[model samples]
Target: MTQAPKADSAALSTDTANADGTADSGAETGTAAPPRPTPIRGYFERPLFDAEAIRGLQRVGVIDVGSNSVRMVVFDGAARSPAYFYNEKLLCGLGRGLAETGLLNPEGRVRALNAINRFSILAEEMDLTSLTMVATAAVREATDGEAFKTEVEMATGIEMRIIDGEEEARLSAQGVLLGWPGARGLVCDIGGSSMELGEVADNTVGRRATSPLGPFRLQQIKGGKKGLKNHIRETLTELRDKVGGDHKALYLVGGSWRALARLDMERRGYPLTVLHEYEMTPKSIRKTIDWLQDQDLSKLRNRTGTSAERMSLVPLATVVLRQLLHVFRPKRVYVSSYGIREGILFEQMPDDLRACDPLIEASRHLEEASARTPGFGRKLFDFLMPLYRNAPPDRMRLIRAACLLHDVNWRAHPDYRSESCFDTATRANLGGMDHKSRVYLGLALMNRYKNPGSNSRLTPLLSLLDPEDIRHANMLGRAMRFGAMLSVKGPNAAAEMRYYPKKEVLELILDPDRQALFGEVAQQRFSALAKSLGVSTKLRVARTAKLEVAKAELANGEAAKAETSS
Candidate 1:
């Protein structure tokens, strides 16, 4: 008999090296085709050829700069799918003891820095181009985070970008799709410091939220409270009622679920302990969760079959799942081997064009997906850029991200999109943020809500902003708001538009016959922003009118040739 030629094992391994659901087959062939890789891997590596290298990245090394753990995972070079990449994790628990203490522990900080240093060296040894170090939750929450971030940069020469929870959740969804193609799954990863949840409607994290309720916090809350279980249940129940239910299939991530599976395996006297190849139903899940919940530290370490290193977190993990189950109530529960780290890796892919900022990126995607017109978004972007030319790079990114996100809510719920954009952009746990960043982006996105004013909370965040940034935001917000107004009035409009500057003033130029909202309130809002930039502005909507006439008078040159020096 002739032997079949080997296809590729590149699809077999991953950072978690979890489950391919065909380990036996994979092992037997040593080089045979994997019947299937996880949907997450395939969903993301679209145009298959574009992602073949994604699986090939097993030799690639990634470091997750998480609040609870600084994990370093490397893939075996031959793995073709992220599902097949073999990787490792280390828990630094940076958020450990930080919630009430109000500071990142020195020990934790040192551990994180050291971990990055080592990971950096490993990445170099591996000669990998795909190395990324990301910080989520704790680092973003820390007061001294910048100092610690700088320490990592100095020590490892890697910039650990602090990201928000929303972006984190989005990326995790991306990675989980590797296994769960096109399924409506509610994915939640409970970390030491935060939990990211995504609702995969139409196989995308179309809506998600990130909260401070990590396993550690959940455990602490359970221990501190009187009616712990009921408290957990009620809190989750209230959360679900308020926010809506998670998908029927609940996907769990982080070490807690992994540990739960191990305990379950021991109870059943399973033959093989390799987790990724493992599967369990709600009956088995509840059984393990119940046992873990009932146990104390002694049992967790000695009898419960959990890693000793993870002993401290088991109680919290149990309560978290317990509460979530009671509240979110999923008919199916699947353990996810992905989280902030994998999410980071998925999003940071060199080819990924998403802005990576939740509010901005989601907003931009929403804007594009929702809009029937093309130039509307570009016109908004072009109109807004000049106003922010003087803003600090950091704030500019946040505000720009908000602007991109502002028009996103137009299609599904136009009336409520401003609020939605504001909520998603601000509250979405996108990593790499400080409170100020969230507040400001939230405020900017919500410009549509309650007229702009100095007395509002978002005002402070905006107050410190470069005067020009305020002007830019104001100008762009007005134009975007107006574009939505006009887009519905029925056809006959310019698709692309821009505003050029003249002596600190801006000239608004739109496509022929574009509608600029007339009458009181809109003009008042528009004028306030224009006035802030020292530019006396007037809207010119008719196309037959010449721009050169305005430009030559106001700028002494064509708006195109005008230089913005000051």
Candidate 2:
């Protein structure tokens, strides 16, 4: 299970101290710099971290031993976003035959043991400060679960904490709130052996319950479809009693539920395939379930690229979902890729850290690591404040995040930079934002360099925005383009820009000496900006005694005639 060693000589170069004496990077600071890439799994075979060198980071490993899969996730940092230093999973089906045999599947037990042994070595290699293994219903309820736990512990030298159904529900609900700051909903997490229901209101967990409504358990019930429906109804009634009333949204966790959502995407040709934050109205989800009930599951399996095992469980999940919708009647349904492991991470974070905005923190990290001028983002935001000062709080947040990320991808190929920016905004492992905000931010970045409407490949994504959204995105892009020069020359030393929307005039004011920097290209871009705003342009200088309006060179030329006429 050991991997070959990876040496990051380049990263080592960044660890020296600056002239002022502060550490240049993690090396001199005696902190674990953000992890450098190692082997494919990143965590295995890395050099051990010196205890004193692991500042600002607390690496915690969570080993989830579920009925269907065994996974190990090492979270390297304790920021608002989860940074997976190392992650590996194996489908061991440790609880496959528990219902019939009344014990762990003998073959599955062996496979799981092997996986756990490998995970233990991997965890040690990662220098994981804290590594804990948590097993759910299958291991907690099985007759020989304790004996299996003893065997696993003896083999891996890692104790497994078997969590009961109720705790499982609570942890999964907490996971939802970790990604969504103020989530209010019913969290339904379907596992291989059981399903848990929990209510969350105004950022706190409410009533909760667990049931044997999982596909594996349902298959064990006597009778066919009719019997399964009756059992689901009975279980749902009890679940409703525990977690009563309608919720704003239904947060779905677990592989089977996600698989269903993915299939729903494939069926509807959803442009954004990201499962996290993907939303559905109750009616839409109900329609999908109805459509699934009559379709040939084999075709669906191929169409959605789902495994036969997962496809098989969809029917049972559909039945459970139908009943859940009927009982909860949520306004919307959302799928969260996060779950118990994220819950554990969230529980460990201090209140201040938990309260930080995940998207903004992640954007700031990207800017620090990649931008040529790191602090320029904030400066650019400050300079452009006049343009967006009237924007709503949510809109301003997205604009601020976009500013931070504006130059992070400057290293990309010139022709591909816009596409790269778009992809990163839409597809990065970002949390805490919904799909609409994701698209808005992505489109703004896309329009930053090239004109966004020209790319047909991006048309599908642009469908998420309306005309007003596109107009606003274009305006943001133009503002970024105008302010890009402020990065090269420090923001304070740069010229100022003024806008007169009522008079349909855009003006640039420069210091007399700094006027040299505003050349032909700058004027052309300024003109383009004016054109975008449907206004005329003027150039002026900040003089010793008074602001002087210089004679407009471009405005009198044929260039002005062509631009203005066009």
Candidate of highest lDDT:
2
**What does candidate 1's lDDT look like per residue over 1-566, in tens digits?**
11111221121111211111111100110111111212232111122212455444445455677766677765333121232243555677788877777678779888777777777876777666455565778888888888888888777766566667776666666555433333365777777788777666443456667776776555556446456676666666655653469467676667766777667766665433444323455666678777655656566457645567576676667667767876777766655554544444444333332212222333344444455642244444444565556656565556555545555555546566565655554444232333334445555666644345666533434433456555555544554454444433211233323334555555555444334434465456556556645567755664455633433343442233234221
Q: What ranges in model 1 sit over 4 Å off?
A: 1-59, 76-80, 83-86, 219-227, 238-243, 293-305, 348-566
The alpha-carbon RMSD values of the candidates against the true structure, listed in the order shown, are 21.4, 12.5
Taking the tens digit of each residue's C-alpha lDDT, what string does model 2 give over 1-566? 22111221121112110000000000101111111111122111111221233333467677889887788888766655676777777777777878898888788888888899889888887776667678887899899999989988877777678877777887788777767666677888898899988787655567778898878788798878888788888888888888886666788888888888887776677788777867776676777888886889898788777787777788878888888888777767778887887776666555555556666767776776799976567667766776676787678878888888889889999988988888878888776666667777888787778775664587787666667888788778777877776437443345667777788887777767666777776677677777877889887777733322322331243355356436
* Residue 230, candidate 2: alpha-carbon lDDT: 85
- What are the lDDT scores of the predictions, listed in order? 0.53, 0.70
**RMSD (Cα, Å) of candidate 2?**
12.5
What TM-score would each prediction reach against the true structure? 0.50, 0.84
Residue 216, candidate 2: alpha-carbon lDDT = 79
Model 2 clash number = 0
**What shift in Å separates residue 143 of candidate 2 from its native position after superposition?**
1.3
Q: Provide backbone clash counts, one per model.
A: 37, 0
